[model samples]
Target chain A: MNRVCIVGVGSPSGDDQAGWLTVDALLDLGIRSGDGVVIEKLDRPGSALIPLLRSTAWLIVVDAMQGEGEAGQIQRFDETGWPHYGHGLSSHGLGVIDALMLAGELGSLPPRLDLYGIEIAGTTPGSSPGRAIRAAATRLAAMISDQLASGFSIPPGTQPGYG
Target chain B: MTESLRSVSIHVPVLARVEGEGALDLRIDNGEIAELRLRIFEPPRFFEKFLEGHLYSEIPDMVARICGICPVAYQATAAQALEKLFGVELDPWARDMRRVFYCGEWIQSHSLHIHLLAAPDFFGCSNAIELARIAPEEVRRGLRIQALGNELMDLFGARSVHPVGVRIGGFHAAPALSRIKEMRDKLRAALPEAEALVRWAARIPVPQDDQGFVSVAMRHPDGYAIEQGRIGVSDGARIEAEAFDDHFAEHHEPFSTALFCTYHKRPYLVGPLARLNLNHAQLPEAIKALLAETGLELPSRNLFHSLAARAVEILLALHEALRLLENYRPPDSPWVPVTPRAGVAIGCTEAPRGLLWHRYEMDDDGRVVSARIVPPTSQNQGRIEEDLRLSLLNFGLDQPDDALRLHCEKVIRNYDPCISCATHFLRMRVART
Candidate 1:
């Protein structure tokens, strides 16, 4: 039962890299690997997420979302609210939600999960995120840190540290 | 009553499930199909052109981007081609390791196609989600099997997607014996699921047709060919891999961006069906016995049975991979060092889809002078058209447009055609009058 933060990232440029940027921000805020928290950056995580979910109790996924929102808008969703986020949230081919659902079907879903989405202006091949999104990336990192420190208490499965 | 007739046109703006984007257009004139086109307008990635002037050593990883699903095929083919030009023999360990790595790919790609992509078509489900609702256990089983394939790739290549372990003369490094044993154990555990998949595929109601099309695949004396073989065609034409370009020609068509390939001025089939049909004799006795238990005869001509063929190959690959790993030992050195030489060489390997052919001409400096890559999908582009034309005739153009479209999609999918691979190398549009 590990608290795993799986960041879905893209090639180092553009809004798609928001996931990695958020991970960097979290690291800067002292969320080191050995601190009972593990972080990973993946490119099109897809079905590869299943094996990772096996040992995870709390899972946080940060990714860029495609939606009709101002650039850098932050959307926080728990397990129940995922479907309401619409299908276009993931910038990757299959997106994080699909992977989560597939994992659920395979009985590989972690008991607790959260998704942080940073809406972006665009994802042009070589372009980086807009300034607003960069600022939002920092904000989202703090929000995640706060949530993790609070013991991810917000949910359907909130049993404290059990082996 | 006065005689009257109306024209019909069916246009699918976006074809689903197959990798990448493409469309199908059908035109009907007075209940008769006047035209059918498979238009693949996905923009070309210009992989072959980009290979020019790159160091020979860099070609494997670069060409791998051609298709995520078959990156190992690209890497191995490129490595073999370059190694041939260098005139170096890979140590037996490297050769066997390459086969095992390739087996992982076949298992991964085939299982994905069978469970996630192709099987739903037979079940009349729109996608895996719906199929899951109908058969939850089956979908979960599929995921598990698919994961095993990825695990195998991870054990050898270090990571499946565009694995970096592949190098010019061999791998960048070899796996430990323990890892090999672990993978072997897992593969053995997955054997029943693989067998079940064959049985499941055997039951899928496929459209029956004796296509009588020319089937082509690689033939090796040792076993089912993956990396090495002579080109064997159903028409009894056997040619060396080096002579691939001599017998086949790629033709450009205005309607589609993918180049349609013709062997000796005729369309042919490849991929799982071709491999199984041609290499049935080469399969191990246990594998052949498993197929016999399915009660389906080998060398099937029904193109729809390609699904079954893919399932059979998955079983074969798992068995072969275990065998390759049985006596695994770390190589003295993972790769044979090579000095670049000036020459033209070719390598043809059976991708999960079909025969992937690569030819490279390099300067003495080891920089590529030119490169030509004929992916499996491009070679099947012509055969797909012929299948569509003939199958549509049997399907009857007078059927409702929706029925026609669904059947057409299934026909295209039966080949499990990778439109993305074709377009990067090379559309599809259908019109009728």
Candidate 2:
């Protein structure tokens, strides 16, 4: 019954620690599970999205990143053209879109899904996390909070969120 | 690839049909191989990182998640490691029961590979699902056979994927003798089906070779080691299970997340082929007959011959299971008492895939101070790279790139490398029954 399926992907300890923070930020926005928002923490991008998408209308996945672009850049996109493990999306063994693609093929996929890829500059092995990710996570939390406060005027599950 | 292509790196993201997500990268520069990374970028789940705060008594419960297919191997190794910490040497029946349990893992995991993984490659299909379309009965039979192994484990562990029965010292609740009897009776029927599978795989015309061999598994004074033997290699690298790190080291490379391991400054093979080559003398008479019936010989060095070797192992597991059932007795205690003490313990057992190595440094209170898990795939990483470099010469560069890429994928697939296991280490998170 959650309005948004918040699928969190990334390592909590690795330096590009923004993704884990993003999940906490989403929760700080008072996005309670089954209140039209479901939170899932995954080790990597995986097919775990299939079941989550089946019942929820809007899917918002959070993950850390290091792009050719600047750090703390939020790469938000609908993963339609994406390969299950997207080309050049070398974050981990399993990428985001490809898992959904496999889910679709396996008859376990839901239609509306969005990935909020937050780029980070580094990995902090054997420690907590970096700074850029924490700040970006805070901003993402505010933006998401604003959208949710508006009741996401988005359709029950249509067009994802960020209304 | 030619001299110009040698510098190129090929990254395969999903390394399919194995246990979990993994990848392979082969770096060849100027026709000399520069690097081979069977990368296990499955994410740092902090398995080893978290065991720091956990009690030693809870070790077995936590380690099972290291692998979905080979939980018994994990359970056995952890139990052994903790036993060293607790000063509980296993009784003979307890040891036998552990072996019987491992036999179940070998049968299930190997059967999965032979049918669901290896068979499709030889049959010209992307997956066994395609093969099922042509031979539904064969596929069904295969699934049923596979499910039988699952059922056996389910008796102890509760599920085919990861069982709950295994613990630090021994089982939580001993399996009823009747249950073992039932599994043995069922195994009697299941044995021939395994032989049939091997016979079919034997007909596939796999590329065979005399690659040098090495194995890290249990060796007994009696015969082939099921648990608790020193490590042995074809080139005479021998040592106790505790001494695995004395000769090998894990390298963290940029290409992949999985750590690559090397023995004696060279890549060496593990898993069924290694076991088959090194411990052929330890195989049982019934399995020897299975090999004879299947028209295969002992000491098959060709890695592809692993399928035949697996079938024979299945026969041995089934035989062992029956014998265990006949000689079964519930132990006086499900688990022996333990007193945690300061010590570094190392344990190794033959996973259905290969040797699974576990080393733990425990505090006086039995808290895990540090942990290192050397999964079979990580050890095989270098071997995979060497095979890739060697395989290129066989695949003339005159061939198309796509064809060559597919061949490369196939060669990598032969190892059934598991990335998830290599990346995870002990930080204890208990799963309560």
Candidate 3:
């Protein structure tokens, strides 16, 4: 069984693909499924995230989010900070935050759960992510690699391997 | 005296615990409802226009995008319709698998609604989280059942969310025997849990606001309808998919983008309760015995009985899937060859919500010329509005605004309205004297 499960949550629409693209970069960096780390890309898994969360000791979720920062800014949050993130009611049933909240209620949350948000300007349907977003995804992948290498205790603001 | 003569209005900016975005506006004058609108403000997604000029082969995948919750419904309806137009007979293996695939959708969608969306209202809880605190075991069980449904879908569709395995004649490919056995084992194991859910749901103390309305669903000759059937109305009328427009009509209201459908110019019921009401006789004997044990009578008038209806269907779906998969074998080919002809194509299936009707005009090259797809939510819109008017009045319009608002939201959510599909939901405003 994999000790670390990295789930990329998003769709094919423009910047929403940030999480999926980040997973791609991680694979390009040689993080295979058999290396104690399982990588997956889910297009709005909703409540389905609960099962995946319980399958690993450490769970890392990467997704595109709107925040008070420039596009492509990367931020990290743990379970404690999730409520402050303002989880609105999703039009499409149990969104990421709602699923996390549900999982927390069910006692299905992993022992270590990390959420990485790639700040995005917008998600246009059928469009690819812009350059800044791609660059940020690469940087985030490298940061995640470093975290895994350092026994999962790497602090935020550690410079990414990429510029 | 002057207060009694004054008019009042109440509005909710957005609805909660239901799928999609929508709001409700209620105006009261002289102690009577002056105006009420279930406004569905989600921007119109012209899925029908998008289907134009698309090849018949692409219809299943494209239509599946309409609802993440019930993609199989869209895919099945589209595939069945095109197959009818092309005169392609499906392999028996494909036929059984299609039913199994649809059962997965019913199980998942009903479980999610019963546990997460609709249950809280009966429990006096604000959301599933609150309900979980009081009923953790039940919530866990619900989640487990839900996960099983998703797995069943993945068995054939490749993935549950907007599954891509469906094709024109049948599935894109067949599942191996090993995967089928794995799913069969899971289905057998879930049967008891599903039955328990039905009993638990039947025990919930729903309001006694019984009212008369017509129930509509698909009726099949062989068994409980899921994938294919004629449109069955509680009034003893049955019609084919092509005749749907002749009896049922969709008209738009100014305040909402979703069309309100009526049977013979009157709002009628659909979805789980309606299905159970129309086809309870067709259910397996064990399921019928279970329903009898709950003491919930068929042709139930109470709208809240929808929760129990959904739970019952979950058990039924599990039983059906198991029966179909018990002797499963990999077919030589999952799909048959298709020859397209220029003509109109029509199909209807029992979505988890209700009857979903699709009509397409096909060209000689098997490309779509025009498409009109009617989802269950839109069909339930008029019925929802009508129910709101009666339920609010019965619940006592003189109740406080918050109490009234919550009541309206509960009533709307009871329908399990996929507002996103209907171009729908409830941000409610009430004006009263």
Best by DockQ: 3
Of the pair 2 and 3, which is ahead by lDDT? 3
- lDDT by residue (B158-252, candidate 1, tens digit) is 88887888889899989988877878889899998888888888988877777678889999988999988889998788998888878999998
How do the residues B1-433 of candidate 3 rate in per-residue lDDT, one tens digit apiece? 5544456687776655345667888887777888788888777899999999999999999999998899999999999999999999999999999999999999988888888888987888877777888888888889889999998888889999889999999899999998888888889889999999999999999988878899999998998989988999999999988999889999988788788889999998889999999999988999999999999999899898999999999999999999998888899889999999999999999999998999999999999999999999999998898999989888976777777777887898899888732111234454443
Task: Encode model 2's per-residue lDDT on B50-71: one tens digit a residue.
Answer: 6777887677778886776788
For model 2, the superposed segments whose C-alpha errors exceed 4 Å read A1-163, B1-20, B25-37, B213-216, B420-433
Native A-B contact fraction in model 1: 0.10
Interface RMSD for each of the candidates: 6.5, 10.6, 8.4
Q: What is the lDDT, from 0 to 100, of the residue B292 in candidate 1?
A: 87
Model 2 RMSD in angstroms: 10.6
Fnat of model 2, as a fraction: 0.00
lDDT of 3 at B68: 89
Candidate 3 regions exceeding 4 Å error are A83-90, A152-163, B1-7, B16-19, B420-433
What DockQ results do all the predictions give, each relative to the true complex?
0.29, 0.03, 0.32
Listed for each candidate, the true contacts retained, as a fraction, are: 0.10, 0.00, 0.40
Candidate 3: CAPRI quality band: acceptable
